[model samples]
Target: MKKFLIHIPLLVLSTTFTFISCTSSKNVDTNLPKDIAERPADEDSQKYEQAQLDKLKASIESESSREKCANASEWTFAPMGAKACGGPQQYIAFPKKMETTLLPRIEEYTQKVKAFNEKYNIVSDCMMIMPPTSVKCINGKAQLITAEQ
Candidate 1:
């Protein structure tokens, strides 16, 4: 009974320390996004990760092209990727019919890219990407068109 009681506090203390170690803390650079890993990915690692991202983006594209688009109202654009300076790197146009599956996957990809950018300390041009004023269908494909505001 005495040994069990004595070890209970030690176990609690050890568990508390373990939990604290795993908890996420605020990063020193408030502007920087949170990193996915403890250390930055090496060059080769970054390349491989980028390849994987390309594959994911390609899959999203393939899924987007599954249906032929006609009406502009049938299409919408989703922001893609995280720019180093903040905001999405660009936007992707897809048919609204696939919104249920496409939006979630796009979000997943965006988050992964954001984490990748943070982990690899990616640098991007601080160019502002404005949202499209409307979507247009040309050559049976959806395209985002921006009008001068």
Candidate 2:
């Protein structure tokens, strides 16, 4: 009887401690950043990726500009940017001579842009980019034109 009385208090204290511990609030780590980039790489990587893509685009454009478009036959158009909804975002004009070099890079760029769009869940206008009907050489640069133009 005497030992039971001593153990009753111990049991009550242990139960009370368990309840108190169970009810105690714990800190949850919420890594919320202000004005954060939509990407997981978070900051510099996105900018670097975009910049590299832009640089490649600029280089490809430079390749097409190496010669005057005196002959429209010497020029052709390639699709650019893989749109989310389907079709290319735009068309690029390149010299037929540079086709061997430019086509692969253009394909690479398109693939990368497609990946970026998919990765970042980038939304784009669903308007389908119709292929240019013909290449036009107004002055020196090659231009893509529709049948109406």
Candidate 3:
């Protein structure tokens, strides 16, 4: 009877150990990629990510330039000059008549800026056009008569 009791406890203990070991082994991790050759290709994914970043940068630049244009107090009719002008009094040669080409371009640019602003939810009082009397031509260059002038 004593031998039977001791054998029964040993049997139960061995059964418990077997169950624990089986459960632990089931939780082992074995699905990890074993080598670089087994990994997924990243080249195409990298290019796609770079293109998206470039597009975002371009949008930001466009928005920034539009905001600057909207905040500008005066517009100049500068041709044969840098794509962008600086300062209040600097001037560049005017290539066409102000009433036709220059005014139209200004209007077009303003409309574009307005549309961009509306799309991006930017708030500003831009696109204010100065009167003809506010314009002055010197050495074939047209400039706005700023307050300092």
Candidate 4:
């Protein structure tokens, strides 16, 4: 009886201590800047972003046979009048199943492309006009567009 009473207090104290320890919160430093770097800072990041933007612009406006188009992750958009376009960069012709979703997105995509092009001074030497080609899907592991024969 005495031994049990003594152990009960000790067990209760230990459990209470453990519970408090487990439930206690520690101060977390969440004020640190996410993308901040020391030397090649925001400027470098912007430059890299611009470079990628330029590449996207190029892929969108590519005309030559050597310039192959890449595939998009979810939905592909090939420009209406281009030979082929790259992923997210090239606007794809809508298939039967994709028309409903993609048709509306085309205008928005155009606006975005125009804005990005204008901001980056992407020359519209090969802007698509009319008669969109087949859409190649990225999900198929075949991520490149084959020009129409």
Tell me, by lDDT, which candidate is best.
Answer: 1
Candidate 3 total steric clashes: 0
Task: Give candidates' CA RMSD values in order.
Answer: 16.5, 8.4, 13.8, 15.2
Worst 10 residues of 4 by lDDT: 80-89
lDDT of 2 by residue, 56-80 (tens): 8888878778879899998889898
Across 1-149, the per-residue lDDT of candidate 3 in tens digits comes to 98999899899999999999999998877887899778765744544444543454355334323322221234344321111121111232233323354444444444444444444455443433332334454443344564556
What is the per-residue lDDT of model 4 for residues 7-36, given as tens digits with 9 covering 90 to 100? 998999999999888767444455656664
Candidates 1 and 3 compared by TM-score, better number: 1
TM of each candidate vs. truth: 0.67, 0.68, 0.28, 0.31
Between prediction 2 and prediction 3, which has the larger lDDT?
A: 2
**Model 3: which ten-residue window has the lowest total lDDT?**
80-89
Candidate 3 lDDT at 12 equals 97
Model 1 spans with C-alpha error above 4 angstroms: 1-44
Q: Give stretches of model 4 more than 4 Å off.
A: 1-30, 38-93, 123-148
Question: Whole-model lDDT for model 2 versus the true structure?
Answer: 0.83
lDDT agreement with native, every candidate: 0.86, 0.83, 0.44, 0.48
Residues 1-149 of candidate 1 have per-residue lDDT tens digits of: 99899999999999998888766463345755577664556756977899889999899989897777799998999898888899988888998888999999999999999899889999999898998888888888877898773
- Tell how far residue 95 is off in model 3, in angstroms: 7.0
